[model samples]
Target: MTVTEVLRRFNRTYTQRIGVLEESFLGTGRPLAVSRLLFEIGSAGAVGVRELRELLDLDSGHLSRMLRRLEDDGLVATTVDGADRRRRLVSLTTAGQQAYDDLERRSDERASSLMAPLTPRQQERLADALATADLLVRAATVRLRQVGDDDPVAREATRRYVAELDDRFPAGFDPGPLAPEPDATWVVATSDGRPVAHGGLRPVPGRDDTAEIKRMWVDAGWRGAGLGTRMLRHLESLAREQGYRRVVLDTNGTLTGAIEMYERAGYARIDRYNDNPYAEAFFEKELSSAS
Candidate 1:
């Protein structure tokens, strides 16, 4: 079979094998969707309703109906968040906790039964394959989009990036804002409506032909998924689209991984172009139509 066909076949097999098509999942008289929602809420203790919608990629109306059903069944409760009165939080009730425990037990038993027929070596191979598949699927599904500098998600990503810098640098870093550049283009990489990475291209002070890349950061958890390269390439593409002929970026000496990534991406070391005290190395790449 072709790769796509093989993937489809595996998806169909797995969904059927897991009883996903059944009206009652795990014999609990609830659909797979409701059961999964309960598991998520139970695992998190308490989570914002908006967060649940983002996590599950569910519409607000659908989630509201599900929450109402769960409330009617005495399995879940929603309350206004103390810190954010305008937002609602969802949590499991006592009966909901019991149901979650039952679901967990059933899931464990089902997994064990599925593994029973496999030899030890076969099981190891299956696990390795699943891990690889999971990584590839997540990497493939990550989405990149351009947003305004002040967009809430973009601002949150910048905050996280600076927080990491402060933690990693010998001297703690300041969370100062990037220089305001009206021409700057900010891009945020998201997966499941959550920002995983961010970067941007902005004008070089006196050089209209050069676009300086700034605020490049990737979440630690997503680093190895080739997301960093994707973000870099996306910024480069943006620079090209904006009619820039060259791009420049800088990094701290302590950021050896980032330095290496830049080198691999065809960026060459350059003299200090800016007086940013924290920057220990600078790199630049000339862009062409073929780039």
Candidate 2:
């Protein structure tokens, strides 16, 4: 079978085995969605309604209906903030906390049952594979888009990137605000509307056919998920689209992970081409038209 077919088959079996199709989940007498929402609120103590909606990627209308149902059942309560009446906060009631505890216990029981038949080694393997799969799926869901350098999200990403560099490099790094220039492009990778990775390309000084990759960074929480490599490839594609034949980047030697990723992505070590004080290693790659 094709890879897509195999993935779809696994997904179907996994969902069914996990009782995701059940009308009630974990025997909580509520649908999976409601149970999941309750779990989030219980874990967080209290959460803003808008934040919950964003976290769950639920439509406002759907979320409101769910909250109303929970409120009617005396499982949840909502209140408006005195400082901001428009902002609604949600919290689980005492009964809701009990229900959440029950759901957690039942969920643990279900997971234990699933693993009971497996040997210890097999269980370890399954856990490792699941972790890898989860990270890969989360990375795949990140959306990359080109944005103006001055865009708030893009600016925020660059600021974080610089801050991280300052912390990591022996000599602190500080960069000026990104200025608009021809053939320059900045891209941000966002997960759930929050910037998680960013990179940019700009024309190389005195070289019309070359671009320099700058400010490539992934959030610390997201670093090991292959997001940096993905962002690098995206920057290369953007450079190609802008008619550049080559791309170069410089990095501090302390960033071994980034250097390794660049090497793996076909970037070759090169002599320093720029006078940036923070750069200790330089690399370059020839871009293909197909990108």
Candidate 3:
């Protein structure tokens, strides 16, 4: 099957698994929204209303109403932010703390009940699949933003990427941003509003519309979650969006997974594009004008 077909098949199984845990866990009369709020607030002990809203992506009025209802039910209380009075912070009341524990206990019981029918081996397999699904889906949820490479998240991603390369390249690697060109777009991927991966595509200094992808990186936990491929696709799409017809990149021989990804993603072998002390393999992909 094609790459798209494989991804689609996994995604369907993915959403079904998420529905089972995140949606089915809420007992009758409780929607996922309220339960999620309670879980977050419960975990934090106390959280700023604004922070919750931002984290949950809930609108102002809606978040306020949820906190108000939690308050009415004696589950939570809100106070002005210590440093910023205008900001309202929400915390569980003593009663709410007890209730939160109950919620957790019941949720655990339900999970256990669901797993009871399976044999020990089946249960183990299920657990592993669930863990893999969580990581894959969580990774797909990260958004890529176009920004400057020196930006904090971007820099962190670059640093991590170079560190990984340094480990692979016996001769060491260049830690600088894409050799600095006027035409480059830096894209960083973030989960929970924190950077976890990044890459860049900059026009080859003297070439017309030909650019190179660089500074690719993904966090340790997210390494095998298909993020590197996604980041590569994201950079290719970005290059195409900027009217380029092709994207080029170079890599050291030691990073096998990255090499495989580029090969599988349709990047054809090319000769050395730069003598950046660490490069061992070079590849490029042509884009259709319609892209």
Candidate 4:
């Protein structure tokens, strides 16, 4: 088949296999936005409004209105925060729990029905492709939200990254213990709410606001999916926002793809500036005109 025909077939098969056309995919006649919020909040017995806002990317006003309507409909109950009375905590009522479960069942049914047509082998391949695509698209869509150094997910990604570096560096790699208080602007990349990629920038000691990128890593199956480029661009944008005119990064020669990506993305070779044992190649990209 021609390449265009192959792509068309792939797209057609993918949407059919993934339940993309289901209108009642979540069990509620409500919009997917509200149903998704209900499901997420249902998973957590009591989730903070602020966290709901961030996790769902909902406007505070809109989320508040949704919560209010849910409350009036006796689906969810809201309470004043113990430590901060002005803030609210939302929890599903028993009635709301029933509704959430109904929605969950319908979602599971629709998903199962989508895959029922494929043979076992075809199902496995489809599932694998979807998983990989989800990770890659998520890496591309990661919005670079500011995360504190102390966040557990941030620390976990750092540990995973450091472990990979240790394997790749001929000189052996030790990025020191996970430093939770580093003056870093960190971001965690999540695919379907699971962290899959991470990179960050922090002060380069006496260089004022100069930030060096560190702990850059993407999950194993995600490497060649353009995650390196996305993470680097995100780190650079964040560094520039924090008054950093230049960004520096270090990597090992064993990571040829990363090296190539950095060079093509505007990083120029520079002398190694740190004692990081893993760093065989150092790069710097000036960002005076960064957005």
The most accurate candidate by lDDT is: 1
> Comparing candidate 1 with candidate 3, which one achieves the higher lDDT?
1
- 91-202 per-residue lDDT for model 1 (tens digits): 9999999999999998888888888899999999999899888867877888888899888789899989999999999998995767656788999987766889999889
lDDT of 2: 0.87
lDDT of 1 at 100: 97
The per-model lDDT (C-alpha) reads 0.90, 0.87, 0.79, 0.79
Which segments of candidate 3 are over 4 A away from where they belong?
1-31, 44-54, 71-96, 139-142, 148-156, 159-183, 191-196, 223-225
All candidates: CA RMSD in angstroms?
2.5, 3.6, 5.3, 5.7
TM-score of each: 0.88, 0.79, 0.71, 0.64
**Ranking of models by lDDT:** 1, 2, 3, 4
TM-score of candidate 1 on Cα atoms, chains taken together? 0.88
- Candidate order by TM-score, highest to lowest? 1, 2, 3, 4
Runs off by more than 4 Å, candidate 1: 148-152, 170-172, 175-183
Clashing pairs in 2: none
lDDT of 3 by residue, 57-90 (tens): 7899998887777788888888888898987888
Highest-scoring model, TM-score? 1
- The better-scoring model by TM-score among 1 and 2 is 1
Between which residue pairs do clashes occur in model 4?
Answer: none
